[model samples]
Target: MSARYWALIIFIGSIWGTSFLFNAVLIRELGPITVAAGRVTIAALVSWLLFFALRKPLPRDPMLYLKLGLLGVFSYAVPFTLFPISQAHIPSGLAAIINALLPVVTVLVSHYWPGGEKIKRHKAAGVVAGFTGAALLASPSLAAGNEHGELWAIAVCFAAVMLYAITLNVARSFKAIEPTTIATIAISGAALTSVPVALWVEGVPHIERIETWAAWIAIGVFCTALAFQLMYRLLPRVGTTNFASNTFVTPVVAVLLGVSLLGESIRPIHLLGMGVVFLGLLLIDGRILKIWRKPVSGTEVVSPR
Candidate 1:
């Protein structure tokens, strides 16, 4: 990867990593539905503005619009709402760590889908190790006797991750569509879906502090809108397999922010679980194992998609 791609990876990772912190702060003042709705609405507006600025035409096909709308519901609205609700019961770091299971989940889901990658021995091992790590991470909450409801929160986070994996497959299926167009339509659909839910569940939200408003804007602009744009741009150059490394970086940043900014405690078990999960991710990616194999000619590897 070039320096610019490297910079994009770091920038996107950092912005997305901080998204958990932003959600934590926003959920303090607003309901999870409200926060999720506001962020998507803001992101849609920003994305549309960029679409116009770039002179890109919106998709005219009704079927495409319908697909994007469904993507919005599954990919954006549902997962966005779930994450914040989960964060209410769990620390942001734990929530972020759970997100690291995306690749494992994706691998498992892909196994059943037609034209998907077959699960090899290494990937099977990765799946087992990854789930073990997840179990280890959630064991403490399970041992808490359901009083704090951390297990439920962990389950919700896993659901969100599953949605993310599904969305990745959905996005990959639309190879003919431009990323920006998909982003704009999906975000708009998410905004449309979330607004009514927010109003029904939380009513209209009031902003009292400038900091809260700033954090809200940051999430929409930097984390959602700009991050999507960067990913779309970088995907062609780096390929999805290389780009997927951002997953490794994002959780680390989230953990750090949770520890330093939010003052959340991290037990030794959490560290061990994170290490195991990362090792599983590395195995699934086939990079470390490739060290003993013959070198390939191309810069790109075929992604599971």
Candidate 2:
């Protein structure tokens, strides 16, 4: 990959990483449902504008719309709300560290899918390590035995990440759809699901603070909308293998932003947990092992022309 591609990948990761910050900020002022609803609403509007500007038509199949609608609810609406709810209790940086488990969970879930990627020996070990790290992160609350809210919040974050992994697995069926179209439809559906619930549960979302507006706009536009646009553009050029690097970069940026800018403090145990989780991710990625593996005597190395 070129320098431009590397920069773009990092930029996308950085943008996504700040979403934790935005959630922490927004959750202070708004209900979790309202915060999520507002985000998807803004993103949905932007997506519609792009849909028209780019001259992309909606999918013709009714079944596809049904699928996308379900995805919207599960993928965006539920998890978006859950993240804010979780952040209300836990530090944004810790939440970000937990969020890193998404890909690992995906690997575990996809193994059960028909014709999905089978679990290799390294992948199995990686999954075990990933869960072990998660247990480490959860240990403080578990040991305390009284901080149920914090423990529950951690579980909720894991649940949200699991939803994302499930959504990704299901979204593989959308190979026939344009990435932009899928996003527009899914986000639009998310808005539709979340808006009514927000209105019912949270009322009209009165915002008196300017900071709230700023945070909401940043999350909606940059984190949700523009990030989706950037990802689709880069995926074809960089390939999914390269794009997965964002998983590593995002949490690091999130941790830094949470500590420095947000004035959040983390324990040494949290750092150790994060390190273990990352080690698990590296194992799952298999790049290090591949680089070190020596070829068998009969094996052939095929060079690209």
Candidate 3:
């Protein structure tokens, strides 16, 4: 990748990483449903405007719309709501650390898909390590004498990641669709779905704080809209494997932002848990381990998919 590609990846990571903090801020003033709805509505509007500005036509296939709607529900609406609700109870950093399990979960879920890569010994070990780390991370919240229901919050985060994994599988089926079109339609569907839910669950939103509204706007424009646009542009240049590696960078940025900007503190055990989870992700990716195990002979080596 060129320096510009690297810069884009880092920029995307930073934007997405800061999203947790934005969600945390917005959830304090608005209900989770409202926060999710507002963000997606703004994002959808921006996406559609861009779609038209670029002279792109909407997909004519009804089946594609159906798939995109499902993608919207699973990928955007549900997880977006869950993250804020979860962060209401847990620190944004902890929420971000828990999100590191996404690739691990994806690996496990993909094993069951037809023509998908089966879990090898290393991946199985990775799954075990990853889940163990999640357990370790959640243990403090589950311990006796703890008043808050942090376990439930962690479970909600896990559920969100599971939905994300399902979305990835759904996305694979839409390989013919342009990335921007998929994003625009899916986000529009999310807006359509979320608005009703938000209205029913939270009623009309009333924002008195400029900072809160600013945070909400930032999450919608920067995190959701701009990040997706950059991702679509960068993916073709960087390739899927390299683009997916943004997962490794996002959590680190989220953790830093949460601690420094949000004044969040992570326990020592949680840090250890994060380390173990990252190790599992590295194992799942298989490149680093493969490189270390390569022979001294100057021969080409192929890493596992």
Kindly list the per-residue Cα lDDT of model 1 for residues 192-267, writing each as its tens digit. Answer: 9999989998898988978789989999998899998888888889987677778888888988998999888777
Candidate 1 root-mean-square deviation in Å: 6.0
TM-score of 1: 0.93
Cα-based RMSD of candidate 2: 4.4
Off by over 4 Å in 2: 294-305
Error of 1 at 13 (Å): 1.3
> Which candidate model has the greater TM-score, 1 or 3?
1
Model 2 agreement with the true structure over 1-305: per-residue lDDT tens digits: 99999999989988989999999989889999999999998988888898899998867899888789888889999999999999988899999999988878988998997767888888887888888889999999988994658899999999999999888888888867898988888998999989999999899988899999999998998898889878877988997667877878888888898899889988888889888888788888887678667455448979999
TM-score of each: 0.93, 0.93, 0.93
Model 3: how far is 65 from its true place, Å? 1.8
**lDDT score, residue 277, model 1?**
88
Residue 101 accuracy (lDDT) in model 3: 90
Show where candidate 3 strays beyond 4 Å. 295-305
Alpha carbon lDDT at 169, candidate 1: 78
Distance from true location, Cα of 151 in model 2, Å: 0.8
